[model samples]
Target: MFSTYLFFFLSTVALISAVMVLLSKKPIHGVLYLTLTFFTLAGHYILLNAQFLAVVHIIVYAGAIMVLFLFTVMLLNLNIEGEFQKSTLMKFVAAIAGGMLFLVLIGTLKSFDVATVGNPELTQIGLVKNLGKTLYSEYLMPFELSSILFLSAMVGAVMLGKTTKK
Candidate 1:
């Protein structure tokens, strides 16, 4: 009963913050809303007992990604409200695409069934070793690739932000 209540509360917060992120006028405010959304999402992940995912979500999205967004917003010195108006055609197309994407995602998640295993008491060896093993073994390539991607993105953003003249 409490779990269901907590789930609904957190989910509502997440959804509302997500909408605010989209509807916000200022990019900085939008980034703040997105950060809140990520925080509430991490809370939901914790409620679901996915501790690793919760921590990783916080670290990646709320901590690192949001900081990068804030830095970009500050660096860009963007003003002038960025033309808040959208054309009707663009809205219609966006609505259609969003609906299709939602349907596809629902269909994909229909196969998911949450079945909890008996709570095996996790020891010190459970977390760090397990995570390290997966990171170094199964996902090593993708992990290395992600590091390279992040490095390249940092370099690219620096290059783009630099002013040049002929």
Candidate 2:
């Protein structure tokens, strides 16, 4: 019961922050709101017993990605004077489209079956130990291949980044 309430609390905060990310006038405020949304998502992952995922979510999204976003926003020097103003007709159309999307989402949620998604008892699949074991034992070949692929991609990126003499 308590977990359910906590889940709802985190979900509500996430939704609000996500909306704020879209509604915020300043780019920096939107980035901050996006970070808050990511934190709430990490909270939800923790509530779901996916601690590893939660930590990664915070590290990758709230930490690295948010920093990159903030730097970009700062460097861009966004201001309202250069902002493109939306026409009244465009705003009305956007509102109607948003309303329709919201109705579709509500209908989808109403039709979702809770019983089909029940959590299994004593599940530890999301834990780092189990994940490492599975990755190293069962999916070792694909994992190693992906690592090599990523390494090659990094090398290619470095080569491209190097300036060639004219």
Q: What tens-digit string does per-residue lDDT give for candidate 2 at 93-154?
A: 99899999999999999998657565832568878998789989999999989999989988
Give the poorly placed runs of model 2, Cα more than 4 Å off: 79-82, 112-117, 145-166
lDDT of 2 at 15: 93
lDDT of 2 at 24: 80
lDDT of candidate 1 over 52-165, digit per residue (tens): 777889999999999989998888875347566698899789989998999999988889876867643333333546667877999999999999999999999889979898
lDDT of 2 at 165: 94
Candidate 2 weakest lDDT stretch, 10 residues: 113-122
> lDDT: which candidate is best?
2
Q: How accurate is candidate 1 locally (lDDT)?
A: 0.83
TM-scores across all candidates? 0.71, 0.79
Q: What is the Å distance of residue 1 in model 2 from its true position?
A: 1.8
**How many residue pairs clash (N, CA or C atoms closer than 3 angstroms) in each of the candidate models, in the order given?**
0, 0
